[model samples]
Target: MTTLYRSLRVLTPAMSETKPSVRGFHGKTSASTDLLETVGRVFLTGRARAHDYMVHVGIGWAPARVPGFRWSAVTANVTDELVQWLVLDGYGFHQAYFHPDRYVRGQYRERRFPWPAGGPGWYVDRAIDQGIGRALWFVAGTDPAVAADLIDGFAPDRRADLYSGAGLAATYAGGVERHELELLWARAGEHRPLVAQAAAFAATARVRAGLAVPHNELATRVFCGMSVAEASEVSVRTRPSGPVGGDVPAYEVWRQRIADEFRASGRA
Candidate 1:
């Protein structure tokens, strides 16, 4: 699979360049419109109205004719309300699938803690930190320079918390349990672009397939020392079968059966 990632720093004039792309597929505006609307309703109120915000936009896709190849673009804006909404909400284009946890309504924790208390700038800064970390992980494994760039992107006081969360998120989303985060930190000097390349490809696939995209079975299996064929089969079994709401339980049963087969074959 081929994957690519690019980063652009948001500037004033550039914000106007990113009007929403024309809708694709079913002729609706791109999925981002829905996200932006939701975000605008939730946070653009009261004293927060006057705050300037930064927005990060990421696009990932596999061309229709391409099977395993993928590409991604990450763009940002300083004034785009849509971008601000995503950053503030701690959700991105892929939030439906890739967020560390599910979104819950009315779940406000006190901002007494310094970590979440940076006010309007807090979410924007967090988004920047995450964008940089993901970008670095996509391009350079755990290179020190990448880590340094992540640190430099934020205020000195916020570095530890921001990178720590970013690292944990990557480890989980990459399906690396155990010491994956530590390993990443230890290898912070290595020149491993494959990590980023794989992520770019996976991101593209996710964009094309949306929630239909299976989690990274190959990576999960590798971490668990399972065979590629076993992992592939597991993925196929887990995919939804037939139309929506049809045979959903049966699909899950098939997934379990495939898991059993992998175990019996000593491939799990």
Candidate 2:
């Protein structure tokens, strides 16, 4: 059986001991390592069936991460359906991050470690989401034209909903919300190979679309996971935006802001 398909097979209670750790909030560790191990194993194997099941689980657990709330209350609230979606969605994100070709120079690198220079796409947030989105778009067999529309539709509108609420901020931040789309695509599996191909296309599209700012220098620093302010210092022409709202500011603006706040609080 394909590694993914085999992962779809539910494990018995006896198999629990083999799973990975499922750490929770407040540094509390759960004894569910067996469950996580099984899930992780299936996830790493890259099987379509496994991905499909995981997507279902991921969706269910998604609500736990809602804004202005504690996940603790919602963690145990997970239903079997939610678990399925979470697993799938998580896997989709993982694939985008770890896919061999997507890696720097077509090589797999440990995600826990920092990426090498001249690595894959710019903007960790953009790269990760775009990769996940492309994977889902592929699984959905979305025509390039339609996929383009979908991406446009989902693109964050900083003006309209930027500071409304925590949920809105989270969505705009493009973290977990982006992963959910990936989960949906994995479940459908319209055409698997399309995932990788679409990711490449999306990366190119981002540059052309100007979603990536200050293309030359900003792209480099972002890909390396450097802060916007840091990149701006070295490249005078690159005036990047603050981590939060506001127009693109000079690097010193942020530096001074930090200094002033620290001084006022007597923490500088």
Candidate 3:
């Protein structure tokens, strides 16, 4: 083991001699590692409950100064912390900094971790876009056509990580032009890949269990696992509002159908 692991085991109250750690985490964690281990396993199996699951996942999200901390001590600490925090409340875990409850009114809510630079947003891509990406997200409201530019502008090497974050954010904050979707498509440029990724994550929460669940607490948890095609099955596909044909949206019907398909096929 690295010196980092040895020191962490001796110093921190996280290490365990008996309980198992998560797959990527180093050494066993505390004897109370059970819940944390379950959360880690769920996360690893991709039932992850965060927006930026693909990019900011694993020990790297909150890495120790020690090189490649996942192999040992970093794992124990992170597992313990995540398990405890998530048990208390699962929101905002993807963010490196703490997030207050959205409705809470405290000065601390506005405060953020001061490190990692770029003020909690991807300054690198915004720099490349000359802030147009951020502007587009605000104005265009996450229509995949327009938002792909935000993802596409990344340096080829950083594209995966950068685009994944951008994609999830757009999905979470969805607000496309309700009336002009077709026109927007006509105006859109070819940035299909990132658009699909963002749209899928965004669509995850709108439907489940043969029903449409809009803005509901349970609906909010349906991210990071379903794909665009799978999401299409679950969502109504049409805009969510308007004089509707049924209680559920078209997308939700599709989502239910997909769910049935999965059940029948016994794959997921």
Candidate 4:
């Protein structure tokens, strides 16, 4: 509750005034996760009223400039900072949903992502790619092959994060059947571990929030080669305890560890 209160205090007047149901934050899962999405939704709601640059700037500011903490209170209960990458997932989703031609079909890349000053721009691009991958699942009508083909259209270097994003969507948003999931798994090729890692992340989110369903199970089995419980467990077990100092963020390290675990278990 303290976390929730602190997070609430940080919101801008416009965001704080908007009356979202308190009930949405009632579960045992981290409110931080929901806040991450909530802030994005708030910006999305203002997209039409604000210029595109301003909206992007707002989303970028929420995490670092908010009160009550150095980081956004949205990250309070998160065990892994890596999940912070989801911040950009909404941006990718918005662009793809509205302008499929430029973002999806044309495969446009943002050269100047003007947010979170001083952070690595290259990493920002990859984080955005994760969102693009998630959006691909929807843009492709949940067809695994079409999504895979769309991801394939990108440079080979970008495909891993793209596949990882798709894996998250397939597991969490789940519209495809078991066979289709298998096809996606097969399609991921060398990036199968990244796919499994993302599936595990999705399973962790679903299971933690008590939102796990049958399709989650099927995707976990196909992509993570484990039951939903086991996949979530893998995510939890491998999470770093605190800050990690390296060229790569602890989030990527967490992801790599999960992927390595899956590979070691022959699930990847």
| Number of the predicted model whose TM-score against the real structure is largest | 4
| Candidate 2 local Cα displacement, residue 24, angstroms | 35
How good is model 3 by TM-score?
A: 0.29
lDDT of each: 0.31, 0.29, 0.32, 0.69
Q: What is the full ranking by lDDT, best candidate first? A: 4, 3, 1, 2
Give per-residue CA lDDT, model 3, range 1-268, as digits (tens): 1332334333221333112331222222242235344333443443223322232233332332334433343444433321122111111222211111221111112132222231222322222221122223332233445434433543455343334333344444333333333333223233223333334434543232222323221112223234444554443443234333543433233324443443444322
Per-residue C-alpha lDDT of model 1 across residues 91-171, encoded as one tens digit per residue: 322221122122111111223212112224334443333433443332223233443454445455544433433342343
**Measured by C-alpha RMSD in angstroms, how accurate is candidate 2?**
20.2
Cα lDDT tens digits, model 4, 1-268, are 2343334344434443222232121122244334334544544355332232223323433443344354534444433245555556645654554456788789888776553344555677877777788767766656788888888998999899889988998898676778889999999999999999999988887776676889899999899878999999999999988877866867778889999999998878
In lDDT terms, which candidate is top? 4
Error of 3 at 113 (Å): 21
Give a tens-digit lDDT track for model 2, residues 25-90: 011123222323443454344334323433333332223124325332333333332122233233
lDDT of 1: 0.31
lDDT of 3 at 242: 36
| Candidate with the larger lDDT of 1 and 4 | 4
lDDT of 4 at 148: 89
User: What TM-score would each prediction reach against the true structure?
Assistant: 0.26, 0.20, 0.29, 0.72
- What clash pairs does model 4 have? none
